[model samples]
Target: MKPSIPPPPTQEDEALIKDYLLHRMLQTVLERDIQIFKTLELTMTNLYILNLQHIIKRMSDPYWTVKHQIRQRGIRIESKSWTPEGEIQVLYLCRGYQRSLLCSWPPMKEELKDRIISYLGTDLAAY
Candidate 1:
């Protein structure tokens, strides 16, 4: 006797999967960005100056390569017929926000950045 193959997902199932994946992806991207920002705050400050553009430029290759790998994984998931659209749009949105957060001059609001830096300073000092 031959082994049975599972039935293809229904349209509803596909839509649910896509939505869930998009939500998870967005959450992951936000978490990663926060971590990156914290790391930069801890490492990139000199006196009172923070050259975020230079830091982002130096970090872009590895950052984008990881994102590309994530997209490739999504493609692989699509090939497996799990999610129909593969959440590519969600990835693009996440990428846009990442650029806005890291590549923009002065990056984010000074108060928010200062809060992050202060949190990091205290956190590291605890170690």
Candidate 2:
């Protein structure tokens, strides 16, 4: 039998991991079609856990919650759906009129784009 593989972090590594997680999460939110105003509250524990299996076993399935900055000043959306790509649960702030930003992600179908436009609001150039 082969020796066991070591996990990524030691007990002492939590702080650096936590800081990196915060910065990355915020950056990811900002770089997307969403613009979050400020981060009022953030709990970094398990913030970067990408695997849904472990989340389903130990915690709530599709586990993620943003109560501080994102909810107070921005948008908070929660949904569970398995698309052709993968099962996903997403929470994000949406740009009500960012057209180019909408195209930045994977190319959505025209129907999807029209639906998104309807949901987000009109294509006002003022934004």
Candidate 3:
């Protein structure tokens, strides 16, 4: 028996893949999971899109290209909203950086925490 081999990616496809890989790396850093390097050896994709140091350059001012703007990657962003109780802080992290809305506020904070746990199946974790 022979193992299946993936077809070679075209130039255009390669470009798209590169762009995605870059964005993914940026996203991971935004999530604040600086421990990605420890798990790189276990992943299938060798692109190493899990490093903060590599993508940190993209977030730090004076480097972001028009294509990988902060708003575009959905990583490293903060928002404040006022509820009847107090202020609510909505933070979007890039660690793994799953581009989902992670909560850390008065109301949304607890809800977001629960949401993250439900999706990732971990409890009491944050960056």
CA lDDT, every prediction?
Answer: 0.38, 0.32, 0.41
| TM-scores for every predicted model | 0.28, 0.21, 0.23
Judging by TM-score against the true structure, name the best candidate.
1
Residue-level lDDT for 39 in candidate 1: 55
Candidate 3 lDDT, tens digit per residue, 1-127? 9976544323433233233333443445445554554455665433434333444553444234533544353344434334554543233344223222322334434543443344344565564
TM-score of 1: 0.28
Ranking by lDDT: 3, 1, 2
lDDT winner between candidates 1 and 3: 3
Tens digits of lDDT, candidate 1, 1-127: 9977544334433344343443343345445665566656554444223333334344456456544554533322322122343313322222122211111213223433443444334464556
Who wins the lDDT comparison?
A: 3
- Residue pairs of candidate 2 with colliding backbone atoms: none
The candidate, 2 or 3, that scores higher on TM-score is: 3
